[model samples]
Target: MTDDDPDRDIRCQDALQAAYRELVSAAIMAGWSEREVVLAIGELADKHLLSLETNDNADALIALLRRMT
Candidate 1:
């Protein structure tokens, strides 16, 4: 962890960054334009944010997203 990270969450940040990078890389590899990738990610973020204040399990979100396809 860097000294600037007072909360010592560098590892978590690293993992999240890796996930984002992989998602973008995969999207581009699969022929999704940059705009399409951003739109898809925005859709996912919207769905995720919608459940943030609900009494819902994260696994249920996974199932819901899977069903979306």
Candidate 2:
């Protein structure tokens, strides 16, 4: 992956995720089920990867949080 490569953005993202795999493990260690961890990671899609309807994702997060209580 290089600056000129169109897939560089996503390539670097994968590399970063590999480096952060421990963080994901830590979330699971903290008692978060795998499904909850996946949902939390999916939330980051709106924040970083796909920026469409950001607020809608946020609203859904809030709703999920409310349901947890």
Candidate 3:
């Protein structure tokens, strides 16, 4: 898979953290309460995972699923 593909499982801990930070910033700017912001971020992550093709990164997806449990 190309390095840019999210399902390629490229090391993305830093990128994910940065993205979460940006989400928090956007939530605050939109006047969302902290709880609402957290829930929104969770939904965003779920949606992102839902968009990926299953065969593109089984290992990475399994690890992520493990963490969710």
Candidate 4:
């Protein structure tokens, strides 16, 4: 198990960046325009901010999204 090391946050940020790169590559391959991806990511950020403001479970946000679809 990884301890609460000093560099933990940096490591996590690096991992997230790698994952984001992979996802963006796949999305481009799937014909998503850069603008669309940016807009969608902004929308996701907005939803997460709303969740934080309401002190709600992020899973509830996912459920709400499923309902919208």
Cα-based lDDT for every prediction = 0.84, 0.83, 0.79, 0.83
Model 3: CA > 4 A from native: 1-11, 53-69
Give per-model TM-scores.
0.53, 0.51, 0.45, 0.56
lDDT of 3 at 51: 68
Error (Å) of candidate 4 at residue 66 is 32
Please, what are the lDDT tens digits per residue for candidate 2 over residues 4-63?
999998888888987568877999999999788888888886577556677679989999
- Candidate 4 structure quality by residue, lDDT tens digits, 1-69: 277788988888787997887877788889999778878877998999997877667668988999999
Best by lDDT: 1
lDDT score, residue 2, model 2? 66
RMSD of 2: 11.8
Winner on lDDT (1 vs 2):
1
- Mark the regions of model 1 whose C-alpha exceeds 4 Å error after superposition: 1-14, 56-69
Score candidate 1 by lDDT. Answer: 0.84
Question: How well does candidate 3 match the true structure, expressed as C-alpha RMSD?
Answer: 10.9
lDDT score of residue 20 within candidate 4: 82
Query: What CA RMSD would you report for each candidate?
Result: 10.4, 11.8, 10.9, 9.5
Top TM-score prediction, candidate number:
4
Candidate 4 backbone collisions, by pair: none
Model 4 TM-score? 0.56
- Cα lDDT tens digits, model 3, 1-69, are 478787655456655788878878888898998889999778887888876756558878888999999
